[model samples]
Target chain A: MPAPAPIDPRGPRFNQAVLSVALLTGFLVDWRPVVPLFALVLLAGAALGPKYGPFLVFYAKVIRPRLAPPAEMEDPRPPRFAAAVGVVFLTAGALAFAAGHAGLGWALALMVAALAGLSAATGICVGCEIYLVLARRRPVAG
Target chain B: MFMARGVIVIVILFAIALAGRLYRAWRARLQDEKPIHPLVPDSLRAGADRTWVVFTSPYCATCGPVEASLRASDPGARVVKVDATREPHLAESFSIRSAPTVLLADVEGNVTARLVGAQAVDDYVRRPPSGVAG
Candidate 1:
């Protein structure tokens, strides 16, 4: 298989920073509107590549140009996995809110926000880390 | 009241993020100094002066630079790249919780030093394992 293109390590973190804010707002205020927006952003990122994701589009078009080139590029898989994980959480959160389970919705949103905030602040991709750990634990196929 | 709740939630999230960062930093530092715990599998043992046993996954994007860095640092050394996804046992046995983890071992397969991220490649090369004459 052909190798995947490497990406600026900062791009995903930048996307996460934007996501953290949206998620925080959703959790703290009215989650009804924000849930769908969050879910759309995350699902787009997960289904498409990070470059195509809304937040990353902003990062690429605006934020990236203002900053110096990345020190190194990385494979897109981990962050894509992270985006997928975000989709799962946000989807569930949205559903909970729609179902009138406010507490559950808030908890899920909080989890996503916390994970995103960690990545944004420390560049520590917790969802990606979780994906790695799970991939490492799955039984190998013959 | 709603604003206060929001602020409290944000504060809690910040605290959690901070704690996670600190824990990761501590683990990375601790692993760098510690030898490979005895639990690592025998297959990882290498018969080389300084073998670079790198643990990577197909999903980890950072592994490319890490592999490149290891090769550049010690062109002559044998760099063994293990796909943690295929060899999950290796990760479990080594207690490898993250990707791009590199273990430097001596000719006898005794792990000399551990590195837990792509960013630590320079440190590993700069401080080559002890007892090997430069």
Candidate 2:
């Protein structure tokens, strides 16, 4: 298989910082619109890659130009994997809230928020780490 | 009451996230002190006096610097770069859950020390714990 594309390490983390705030606000307000919007953000990131992701678009077009080039470029797979994880949580939360399971929905949303906030604040991508572990354990195809 | 609950929840979420980060950092540091004798893949076995096995992934930005530092620090030791994505089994054998994880091992493939994340070359060159015979 071909090697994955390289990305500025800051791009995903910046997107996560913005996402954490949106998620936190969505949970605190119990705002239904916030859920779908946040889910859309994660969906774009996971399916389309960071260049096409909304928050990352902002980072690439606006923030990245102002800063010096990154000392190193990273693989895009891990952050994309992280975005996939976010989509799972966000979709589940949104559905739960729509179904009137407010408590469960909020719980799931809070988990996403916490994980995003952790990555934003500390640059520790737990979802990415989990992906690595699972990928290693998966059986290789012939 | 509702406002207070929201505030409490937010605070709790942040606190939990921070705690998890701290715990992982602490654990990574602790893992460095002991020799876990991680398994080495055939491709990585260099048959050298000391081998620097670097576990890296495509998404690891800091990995390049770590590899460079290790190579610069010990010209004598063999440095092997393993792509965690392509060689997941290698990562699993070493119990590597994160990128840029460096394992210092002996000729017999016994891990002497493990370093996670970015560090100076000196950090990697430091002598391993005496308890485990290399």
Candidate 3:
């Protein structure tokens, strides 16, 4: 496969910030629907591309215009993979909530929120790091 | 009820963050020069004057590249690959929770350096085993 296109490093941080806040709000409000809705958003970004992601597109069109360009761009694949991870956790959390397991649902959602918050605050994306490790498995020339 | 749930959420968030921090610290500890106590059996231990025993699991994506890189860096060096998943006891004995953990040992089976994770592959390649021609 061809290399993934690069994106503004700030865009992912923006997405992470929104995701963290949304997830925490969902948990605090005991709004079960919020988890799955955000999961769908993440799924769209993972399955399609940054252009299809509401948060990323919003960043590109609105937030990005207000700020100067980043000094370096980053590969989009890692963040896309991170979106897929978020989808998995949120989907599972929604399922748990649907099954009346509030504790499990909250645990899953909170885990994702914590990770997203860390990425947003410290720029240390655990899911992206996992993606990079997996990406390195691709056959390299001897 | 909502207030209680809010507290639960905050607690869970803190728990996750604490777990992450603890994991990083543990990994760092494993990277220190901790010898392989109660030396491994002859079948699994280093067979040469200097060897790099790479503990890997089947699920580890970077294991193959890490092994390949080590071999490429030193054609004559002894590189042993042990599947941690298959050998759970061995992995447990060495306190190996992660794959691609490279342990450098001398002829006596005494570990000199402990490198873990994909990042360690570059580190080992940069500074190979001492007193042995790379």
All models, DockQ values?
A: 0.39, 0.26, 0.11
Q: Which is the leading candidate under DockQ? A: 1
TM-score, one value per model = 0.74, 0.70, 0.57
DockQ of 3: 0.11
> Residue-wise lDDT of candidate 2 within A1-142, one digit each (tens)?
6556678879999988888888777666667667668889989988977767999999999999999988556777777888899889989988998898988887787788788878877777899788656665662221
In the range A23-99, model 3's lDDT, one tens digit per residue, is 88887887878789999888888889988889989999999999997754566777888889999999999999989
Q: Pull out the clashing pairs in model 1.
A: A75-B61
Which residue ranges in model 3 land beyond 4 Å of their true spot?
A1-18, A27-33, A44-142, B1-13, B20-33, B44-47, B129-132
Q: Chain A structural similarity (TM-score) per candidate?
A: 0.90, 0.92, 0.94
Interface RMSD for each candidate model? Answer: 4.2, 4.8, 8.0
Superposition error at A60 for model 3 (Å): 13
Query: Which candidate number has the best lDDT?
Result: 3
TM-score for chain A, prediction 1: 0.90
Q: Each prediction's Cα RMSD?
A: 4.1, 5.6, 7.4
lDDT of 1 by residue, A64-112 (tens): 9999987657777778889888888888988888899988887787788
Error of 3 at B68 (Å): 1.9
Alpha-carbon deviation at A61 in model 1, angstroms: 2.1
**Residues B3-111, model 2: lDDT tens digits:** 9758856696668677777878887786665545555654576578778888887556677777887787677888989888787676777787667888877778777
Error of 3 at A123 (Å): 11
